[model samples]
Target: PHYYSLLAAYLECQKVGAPPEVSARLAAMTQELEARQRTALGGLGAATEPELDQFMEAYHEMLVKFREELTRPLQEAMEFMRRVSRSSARSPSRADRCAISFPLA
Candidate 1:
């Protein structure tokens, strides 16, 4: 269950901050995720219980953590976009616009 454990640890890292051992743990987790993916979707597909549960839990947990982390970045980006839109509507030159333009024709 080293792989499974590594995945949990990776989730913890992303939630807080990548731990000192995250480098090594992530490497292991990557391999494990790959193996599980292959097994689940391989040509000779066979439903696995324990392995599937572990991998699915890791995957779901990772995604949830990722989404949580992205909340701030996404909000910031949206705010930036709104600012840019307002700026562009107010003034073209100071709107963070690029001078380069190409004609489709």
Candidate 2:
């Protein structure tokens, strides 16, 4: 779910013309998070109760770091899109300014 969410946001960032470096970094981070999840899940079957508890603790910590790493780029992309939308709204295109004829009701 997290991966998909991030992927969607990354794609949106690209669509909204966020910086290439920012999008690339985000894509890399998303892939890294997915890899970590896969690795963690793969080791679960071999863990004893105590080890499982330790793994959970470490996994939680990793998630916290992952969230921190992912948040910055997403925020930057959102801010960029906000600015873009604001500017676009402020400056209408020539077509946008043209009057549309409507039939009288």
lDDT of each: 0.64, 0.63
RMSD after Cα superposition, model 2: 11.7
TM-scores of all predicted structures: 0.31, 0.36
On a 0 to 1 TM-score scale, where does candidate 1 land against the true structure? 0.31
Candidate with the greatest TM-score versus the true structure: 2
What value does the lDDT take at residue 32 in candidate 2?
76
- For model 2 the TM-score comes to 0.36
- Could you tell me the lDDT of residue 35 within candidate 2? 80
Return the top candidate by lDDT. 1
Clashing pairs in 2: none
